[model samples]
Target chain A: MSWNVGVWIASLLTLAIYSFLYKDNPFYKVAENIFVGVSAGYWAVVLWFDFTWPNLFEPLINRGNVISLIPIIVGLMMFAPLIPKISWLVRIPLTFTMGVAMALVVTQRIQGEIFPQLQATFLPLAGVSPGVLISNLLIIIGVIATLIYFYFSKEHKGVLGFGAKLGIWFMMIAFGASFGYTVMARISLLIGRVYFLLHNWLGII
Target chain B: MKQTLPLFIVFGCGFFMIIAFFIPLGGFQDVSQTFENWYTGVIAFFVFVGILNLVRVNTERIQKRTRDWQYSIILLIFLGIMMVAGFFIGGREGRLFLYLFDNFYIPLGATMFSLLAFFVASAAFRAFRARTPEATLLLIAAVIVMIGRVPVGYWIWHGFPSLVEWVMNVPNTAAKRGILFGADLGLISMALRVLLGIERSYMGGGKE
Candidate 1:
């Protein structure tokens, strides 16, 4: 078995968190609070070392990039909310961030998601094996039917209703598959923790 | 003056990015790259804001002697320890910081997420009823997927894996693509509204 202090501490903490399965108690709360605190501190260190030091401070101080000061000053403006008199100054940084973020989303969605998906959906159905042809036809039909289901402008009646019904079936199947995969992922994580308990901490395995 | 200045900044930055996307010529790309870096820098400072807010809230709770105020003390203590280890000892390369992350953080994080497996399974048991044809299809799909993904599934039937693959590739892709198209169209329009200053909700409420 491992005699390492770190491993011991980790094992205790893991058990502390898992004790919540029995009931909510002080140990679980302590573990939860520690998790929150450590996570916040970790992010702070990462932001300072990985982001601010390298991107903002290094460029402004060492490389003498005057333009870097623009963001630094704006970033500092985020602290304006601490002061009642000039709290509105925070809006500047907020708007700047929002503008850039929104613009990127618009362009990226068009180029990355919308176009590629449409291209993939519009496959040629000319020459192929019977199985390949059936699969391709299903894909094309499924996409159109699903789109038609989401089309709320026209009421679902007659052929539109049939298409919408087909769409619901397709979506239900997809959602079921997604849920199954997610469950497996979580179970795998549980298995990993169990393995750590048995093999690493106790040496049973 | 406050509101107008911010709105103007939004318009300027938003239009510049959209234009730069189309052009990408001369110094446009370089300036755009700089702006991207600046965005990252600005966003980084929010982490400090968040940590400070967390500290302030916990400190208040301790002072008020709220329910389980003792936990706040532990939280602040660990937060301080992590920050000290990170800054003084060294950032990522520091022995103490890395030890805390590898032992404390990883185990806690993984265990927390893994606990969801029990809840998900319980929920599935209750909710996976086949009252309708659609529900039956969903149940069938889920069972096939779960069984086919594991080694025991192949022992039961050779074709289980391929059927699962077909369900994923065809129906899953189609459903996801349809949703994505609808969602992206809405997002693009909303983004345009923000750019044009029609959506002023982000600026918060006040006079002008």
Candidate 2:
């Protein structure tokens, strides 16, 4: 088995973080803090090299793109909070950012998620096999009932209430499936650690 | 100066971008794309701001000698080391940077998330109690899905995997799609409220 100092360091840090399962301790805290600091620093460097330099600075300097200055100035306005006298200036950029995101997402989400999902639910009911027919029927009932559950304009009574009740069952099952899937994911991660320790570190596997 | 200006800025940029999406004109699309690049740069600035804030907070903690302030020193050291490695030595492609990332960062992140397995087990133990009819339904479904997902269940019964697949594809998809539709509709309405300046909370507080 091949062994190295980097692998040793990784194994120890992995163990240190896992030590948190027993209780909170210095090893865990140190590992946690280092993780945060390193991640932030890494991302900061990435943003500068990947985004700011190529997209913002290069254009402004090489091409004399004066328009790039507008965002640079607005971005600097975000730091107005550091100066008590000009704190309110931060609001301008914040509003612009929020508004732009809102506008873009409003249209994009409809086009991407809402429209496609609705179209997908248009399963052909006629001229299909028994299994396909049953599945399609379940999907239709499930969608309509779930939508009814969320409808707040009118009080749920009789048929509407029954549909809502059915909706709740479907929702509960979905949530349960999600929970199970998450548990499986977590267990898979744990298995990875175990495999690393056994195969890489101990050479036992 | 405080309120009205920001609202107007939001209105102008928000409406302009939305209108640009519809218009096939060159100037509109160019303006929209340029503003998008600007937004991207502005977002990059916020990352710097975030790092600065973290440094400031940690520095203050170390200076004041707060609880476990020594850890803060370690954090700053690693942060500085990482930045120097990335910026001066080379970007992430550098040997030292990749060494630190592959060994230190990857292990820490993986172990951190792996720790959740233990907690999730304990949490599931508590959650699986069938106190009500709905709770019972949830518990039963969860148990079935969990069992069906693992190989041991298939060992006990060969049909477990297919049963799990059916549950996931049919009921789960239907339920999730329904929830997504409702949620997206609400999201659009909220976005509209923000664009219209009815929701000024993004400026720090209630509508102004």
Candidate 2, residue A62: Cα displacement in angstroms equals: 3.6
Report every candidate's CA lDDT. 0.90, 0.86
Candidate 2 lDDT over A71-177, as tens digits, reads 87888898888988788988977887877887788879888999999998999999999998988988888888899999989899999999999899888888888
By summed lDDT, the worst window of 10 consecutive residues in model 2 chain B runs over B199-208
User: C-alpha displacement of B129 in model 2, angstroms?
Assistant: 1.7
Give a tens-digit lDDT track for model 2, residues B34-153.
Answer: 877777778888888899999999999999999999999988999999999998897868888888888888878888888888898899897788898778877877877889988898
| Docking quality class, candidate 2 | medium
Off by over 4 Å in 2: B205-208
Per-prediction TM-score, please? 0.97, 0.95
Candidate 1 chain A weakest lDDT stretch, 10 residues: A123-132
- Candidate 2 root-mean-square deviation in Å: 1.8
- Model 1 docking grade: medium
